[model samples]
Target: MTSSNTTDTATARREDPPTTAKKKRSRELIIAQLIGQVALLLAIPVLTRLLSPAEMGIYQTGLSVALILQPLATLRRELLIPFAGVRDARKHRWIGLGFAATLSGAIALVALPAWALGNATLAETLLATALILPSFALMYVENAFLIRHSAQGRLAVRNLVGGVLSAGLQVVAALILPGAIAIAAALLLGRAAATFVTVARRTPSSDVESPGEKKSQRSISAILSAMIAAASSQAVVIVSFASLGPSAAAQVAVGQRVAGAPASLIGQALTQIALSSAAPLIREQRPGMTSQLRSLTIRTGAAAAVTAAALMIGGPLLAVPILGPGWEVAGVMTAVFAVPLSLTLVALPATTLLIPLGRERLLVSLQTVRLVAIVAAIVVSSALTQDVFTTSIVTAAVWTLAYVPLMTAAFTATVAHDRLCAQVVNQSSAP
Candidate 1:
C-alpha cells in the first residue's frame, strides 16, 4: 500500500508540470486579451466624441465587409495549420497570402466601377477593405501557426501589440484625418505592423514533419462554412447599413462592440487553447475527450449566462457613459444584444471542437441556417417597422432562437463523432 501510494504521488508530481504550464499559458493569453479589450473599450468614448454617428457607421460597415471577405481570402486554410505537419503549415501560410492578394486585387477592380459611378463612399470602403485584406490574412495564418506550436507567450505579445496599435492608430486618425476612410486606413496599418512583428520572430524547430499528415479534403467545406459564418455574424451590420441607413447601423455596431466584449474576451481566450489542446486528443482518439468538451461547453455557458444577465441589467446605464452623449440608443441596443451574444459565447466550444472533429459539412449547414434566419429577420423587421430599435429587438430575438439549434446540432455531432471514433478504436484493438 505504501509503495502504491508513493507511485501515485510520483505520477501526480510528474503530471503537475504540464497541467501547471497549461494554466500559466491560459492565464497569460487571457490577460493579454483583457488588456487588448480594455484598450479598445477605453478608445470608444474618444472615438464617439470625435467621429459622428454616420462616420462611425460607415467605418463599421467597411469593417463588416472586410470581415466577411476574410474567410474567403484565406480559404480557411489557417484552420488546417494546427492539425498539419510543419511543412504543410508553411505551405498553407504562403498559399493563404497568395489568396489574399488575389482577392484584394479583385476588390480593387470592383471598387473602380464604384468610383466611376460616383459612389465615393462605396469606392473608399472597398479600396480600404482591399488594402487591409492581405494584412488580416497574414495575421490570421501566423496566429494559427503560433497555436500549432503552443507559442502562447508569443501569441499573448501579439495580441497586446495588436490591440494597442489598433486602438492608438484609430484615435490618432480620428484626431488628424477625421473620416471613415482614415479610420479604416489606421486599422490596416496597425494590423500590418502587428503582423510584421509577429512574423519577424523565429519559431522553434521542434515540430516534426510527419508523413501520416495528409491534406484534408474538407478544406472546401471549411472555407465555405467560414465564409458563411463570417457573413452571418456580420449580417446585422450589413443589413442595417443597407436598409436602415448609417446612423442606425452605427448604433448597432457600437452596441455590439460594447455588449459583445465579455463573450469576445472569453471566446478568444479559450479558442486557441481549445484548438491546441483538443487537436492531439481527437487525433489520437483519446478517452475522456467527449467529457472534456462537454465540461468546457457547460462552464462557458454558465459564465456567459451570468455575464449576459449582468449586461442586460447594467449595460444601458453604462453605455451612455462609455460611448459618450448622443449615443443613448447605442446603450439600449447593448442591452438588447446581450442575449444573442451570450448564446454565441456558449456555442464557442462546440464550434471549436467541430474543426478537429472533421465536421465541416455540419458547420456549413448550421451557418447557412443562421444566415437565412438572421437575414429574414432583418428584412422583415425593416419592411414592417423601419425603426432601428424595433429592428434590433427582432433581429436579436431571431438570432437567439437560431443559436438553440446550432448549439444542439454541434454538441450532438461532437458526441456522435466521439462514439464512432471509440468504436473504430475498439474494433481495431479486438482483432
Candidate 2:
C-alpha cells in the first residue's frame, strides 16, 4: 500500500505545474531585459525635457543609421553564436571577429568623405559610431554565451549593471550637453562599458581558428536569408530617413521606442531566451517543446495587450507634461503605435525558429515581405499626407497586419518540422 501511495505521490508531483515548470533561465533573462528596456523608457521622458524635438529627432536619426551599420559590420559574428557549436564553422568565432575589425576600419574610411563634404558634425558622430560597431557585435556574443551556458545569474547581473550604467550616463549627458552627438556618445559609452565587462574577459586563445570541413550551423540558403533579412531591417530606417526627412523619421523612431516597449522588451527577451531554452529541446528530440513555445507566445501576447492599453491611455498624459508641451506630438504618436507593437509579441517569438530550425530562408522571405510593407507605407504616407505622425501610424499598422500572418506561418512550420524530426528519430532508432 505504501509503495502504491509513493507511486501515486510521484505521479502527482510530476503533473503539478509548479514542480514541472520553473522557467528559471527565462525568468533571469526577462528580469535582465526588463531593466535595460525600462531604462530606455524612463530615458525618453527625461531626454525630451533636456533636448528639443529637433535635437531628439537628430539623435534618433543618427542612432537609426548606426543601428543598421552595426549589424552589417558583424553579420557573420552574430551568426557565429549558434554556429559556435557546429564543427564545420570551426575557428569561425575568431575569424569573424577579425572580419568585424576590418569592416569597421573600412566603414571609417568610407565615412571620411563626410568631413571633406563639409558635414563635419555628422561625420564625427558617424566616425564614433563606426568605432562603436565592433562593441555591439561583441556584446551580442557575450549575451549569447551566457545563454549557451545557462549562466542566468551572470546574465541577469550583467544586464542590470549595463542598463543602470547606460541610463545614468544618458541622464548626465542630456543634462550637461543637449545634442544629437552627446546622446550618441552617451549611448556608445554605455555599450562599451557593457562590452568591457562581458566580452573583453574572454582570452584571445579561445577564439583560435580551426581548419577542417566547411560544416555550418545553417546552410548557405539559411545564411543568405539571415543576411538579407538583417540588411532589410537596417535598410528600413535608412529608407525612412530618405523618404520622411529627419523630423518625421525621428517621430517614427521615438514613437516606436516609447510605444513598442512591450514588444521590444518582452518580445525580444523571449526570443533571446528561446535561443538558450528551446534550441536544446529541439536538438534533444524533445516532444511538445514547440507547442510550449507557442503557448508561451500566446501568454506573452496577452500580457503585451495589457501593456499596450496602459501605454496608449497613460503614455500621452505622462509624456506631454514630462517631455514638455512642444513635443506633445511625439507622445501622441507613441500612444498610437502601441497597439501594433502589442501584436509583435507573436512575431518575435515566432522568429526564434529561424535560428534553431535553420529556417533562415523562411525568415528572409517573411521579413522581405515585412520590409516592403513598412517602406511602402512610409513612402506612400509621407508623400501623400506629408505628416510624420500619419506616416508613422500607417507604417506601424502595416507591420502589425503583415506580421500576424507571417508569425502564424512560421509557428506552424516550426511545429510541423519538429514533429516530423521527432518521428524520424523514433523510426531510425527503432532499427
Candidate 3:
C-alpha cells in the first residue's frame, strides 16, 4: 500500500505541468483583465477629483497624440511576430529595434528643444511623449517575446504592474505636481518602470527563438504595413481632438475608457490567447484552425456586445457618482462610445488572421480606409452638428457598420486562400 501510494503521488506530480498550463494561463489572463478594469474604476474618482475636467481633457488629448506616434517610433513591433519563433530573425530584429528606439528617442529629444525655441504648439507634452520612446519601444519588443513563448503569466504581470504603477504615479504626481504635467510625467515613468519589469522577469530575448520554426525576415513593406496598422489604433482620438477641441476630445476619450471597460476586458484577454494560437495556424496553413477561429470570433464578439449593452445602461448611471459632477458630459458619452467598442471587438480576431495569412498589406489597406472614414465622419459631423457627442454618435455608427463586414470578409478570404495554397503545395510536393 505504501509503494502504491508513492507511485500514485509521483504520477500526479509528473502529469501536472502539461495538464495545467492552459488553465493556469487562462486564470492569469482573467486576473490581469480584472486588475486592469478595477484599477481604471478606482482611478476615476481620484483623478477626476484632483484634476479638473479640462486638465483631464488636455492630458488625454496630448497623450493621444503620443499614442499615435508610438507605433511609428517602434517600426511597428507587430511586424516582429512571424520571426518571434525564429533565432536569426529575432536577433537581427532586436538589434534593428534597439537602433530604431535610440535614434527615435534622440530625434524626439532634440526636436523638443527646437520646438520650445520655435515656440511650437504643445511642445511640453510632445517633449514628455518623446522621452518615453525608448522604454515604450522595449515594452513592445518584450511583448513579442512573451507572445512567442506563450508567457501569459509574465504578460499578465507586465500589464498589472505597468498599469497600476502608472495610475498610482498619476495620483501621486497630481498631489505633488500641478496641471497635466503630473499625468504626463506619470505616463513616462509608468512606461519606463513597466519596460524594466518586463525585461527583468523575462526569459532572455535570445530564448524567444526556437530552432525548429521557419524564419521570417522583416521587410520594408511589412514594416510599413505594420506602422500603418499601429497608427490606425488611435486615429479616432486624433481626429476627435482635431475636429472637436480639447474638451470634446476629453469627454470622448474618457467615455471610451470608462464605458468601454467590459469590452476592453474581454478583448484584451481574447487578444492575448488569439494571437498565440493564430500565429501557428496561419504559418502552417492549417485549414482546421479557421473553423475554431471563426467560432471564437463569433462568441467573443457576441459576448462583448452583450456585455457592453448591459454596461451602457449601468455606465451612465455610475459616471456622475464615480467621477464627480464635472464628468456628467462624459457619462452621457461613455455608453455612447462603448457601443462602438463592442463593435470593434470583432477586429481582434479578424486581425489575428492577418499575421498567419501574411496578409498585412490587406490589413493595412483596410485600416487606412477605416481611418479615412473616421476622420471624414468626424470632420463632417463636427461641421454639421458642431457638437462633440453628436459627432461621436456618427463616428461610432460608421465604425461599427463599416468595420465589421469588411473585417470579417477579409479574415474569411485570407484563411481560405492560405488553406487552398497549402493544399496545392502539399499535392505538388507529395511523392
**Best-fitting candidate, scored by lDDT:** 1
Tens digits of lDDT, candidate 1, 160-189: 788789889989999998878787777778
**Which whole-number lDDT from 0 to 100 does residue 70 have in model 1?**
87
CA displacement after TM-score superposition, residue 145 of candidate 1 (Å): 0.9
lDDT (tens digit, per residue) of candidate 2 on 1-431: 99999999999977887533447656877888788868866888788778776667666665655555554555544444543544323355555556667877776787689889997655654665565566555556566655544455666766766767777888899899887667666766786687567642344553553332124555454445545544444444456556655555555567667776677665556766666556556555555656767787778778878888898887778766766666666678778778777776766666656655656667667777777777788779988998766766787678678766667767776687678878977998895
CA lDDT, candidate 1, residue 100: 89
Query: Against the unseen true structure, what C-alpha lDDT does each candidate score?
Result: 0.78, 0.65, 0.65
Candidate 3 lDDT over residue span 307-377, tens digit each: 77876787788878888876777777777767767755667656645654556666666767776787788
Pick out the ten consecutive residues of candidate 2 with the lowest summed lDDT: 206-215
Off by over 4 Å in 1: 1-7, 200-204, 211-214, 427-431
Clashing pairs in 3: none
